[model samples]
Target: MTNLSAFLAQNAIKPDSQERVVSKRFVDPETKEPMKWQIVAVDSDRDEALRKQNTKRLPVPGKKNVFQPTTDYDAYLATLAVECTVFPNLHDVDLQNSYKVMGAEALLKKMLLPGEYAEYLKVVQNANGFDVGMDEAVEEAKN
Candidate 1:
């Protein structure tokens, strides 16, 4: 029989938080240097919740009392980015007021430019382990 002890929660490796220089726009006032954003890998439960929140059910036009589920990908990513970010406090009221935005998602959208926003979303996805592919993992394992 295989040793299952290593798979136990206590024995398993925990996800570590990471700091990344996502953008050069935000800088320290005194240091005149870019600030790194803190991010962490969120558990699957949180991701599932976000997914469900973004998904909407629409009534099927031809069917009786039936609905088709659809997910808003852009909304999901925006929410995910806000959830994973740990530094500069996206939820801070002062930050939101400064950006003239009401919510965390809105603040993030307003802070970064169009291209920067797209790149930041990619960075957020990567932090959550979405950047790796099966082929890349296989290659790394082989090496």
Candidate 2:
């Protein structure tokens, strides 16, 4: 987590940017090794372009709206929680709960295994804030 903050700072990720989302740790299944988590913002333009390219289908309609990349913090966190693969009981519980709360918003997608997601959650829980990078973004935005 601390390392992730540093990496983000080194990369100049802006705190105020709507694209900013907290990254979580994930574990690789093949080797059972832990890996850094990543936060991803929704790429609406790219998605739209994809949809246009594949107009044969309507993109399951409203699915994108249910989980827009930036604002879906809970969904995003939930996504990570399901990816760590370290915890199964917790993952299943969270998935079931999220399914109910989201009313299929999260159900439509597959979640990471419990064991994998658990390990990842451990890394995320210790996640750090990117103070230096955030400061730079603030200054840059002001300029």
Candidate 3:
């Protein structure tokens, strides 16, 4: 996994364009809720504008902040790429490799298992090509 991690780590794109916009988000741990933060900077100076943009964009909702109990995370900020609105964070190859190694199906199952739909496990089993009577399990759950 070290190679995979290294590949991911290196593939991280460094921000290039100067003009950036930033927004803040604060999370409520008890409910895992997020509040959109106010936008901070728009300066005439390129350096100042870039600094503000970097500061504004970094924090992502589920990926970065997990809400630790000991300290106040209000100071913590993340600046995400504005282009991500149009595209995904990682390239196709990286995403595919990540899925292969991380087993995104299992992650989805773990997240969805608590809901009223108990077919998460069945779906995951089927996706993984397990012959564990998944069709019957899914059909039964649907009923």
Candidate 4:
């Protein structure tokens, strides 16, 4: 096979995105009830606006006051961009006013709860065709 053909064959896109259901029932922090969520890996849109969003970044407020991603959660709620908003802090907020002009793709990096963050990372890595096995590797190293 020619080198050109080999290169073309190497980058085939998967027909379906990766998705995983929560294995164990989780307690909804607020409702105190069992909850199950299906986490799905999605594609990032390469639109001009989105590109601009990524290019633009929020400044770190430093030691005194750190920024909160949940503050911008409302915006993602409208676009349902939770999958894309992986880097922000996801603190529980009853305020409907949160999630606004958070500076470009603020949703790109929300601070999620530890478990939620791990799940989000899994989706992102899978979308990028990365095996999310660093944790497993670390565990194996300990043995």
The numbered model that scores best in lDDT is 1
RMSD of 2: 14.5
Q: How many backbone clashes does every candidate have?
A: 0, 15, 8, 13
| Candidate 3: tens digits of C-alpha lDDT, residues 5-53 | 5458568654332211111233456766553212222223642343344
Candidate 3, which segments miss by more than 4 Å at Cα?
1-117, 134-143
> How many pairs of residues in model 3 come into backbone collision?
8
List, residue by residue over 12-128, the lDDT tens digit for candidate 4.
Answer: 554454444332344668987655434334444532233333332344567445543222222332233344333232332422125442533343333235476456555545554
Candidate number that wins on lDDT, 2 or 4? 4
lDDT score, residue 24, model 4?
Answer: 38
**After superposing candidate 2, which stretches have Cα over 4 Å from the reference?**
1-69, 89-123, 127-143
lDDT string for model 1 (12-131, tens) is 998788888877988999999999999887899999899889888889899999988777777888999999999979999999999888999999999889988887887888878887
Task: Give the number of the best model, judged by TM-score.
Answer: 1
Residue 30 Cα positional deviation in candidate 3, in Å, after optimal superposition: 28
TM-score of each: 0.87, 0.21, 0.16, 0.33
Question: In model 1, which regions exceed 4 Å deviation?
Answer: 132-143
| TM-score comparison, 2 vs 3, better candidate | 2
Q: What's model 2's lDDT at 37? A: 32
lDDT value for model 1? 0.85
lDDT (Cα, tens digit) per residue for candidate 2, span 1-143: 25566667468654321211222344567766664334323244643443343333224355773432222333444443333223333335566685564432243233445665443334443332323443463453233
Candidates sorted by TM-score, descending order? 1, 4, 2, 3
How good is model 2 by TM-score? 0.21
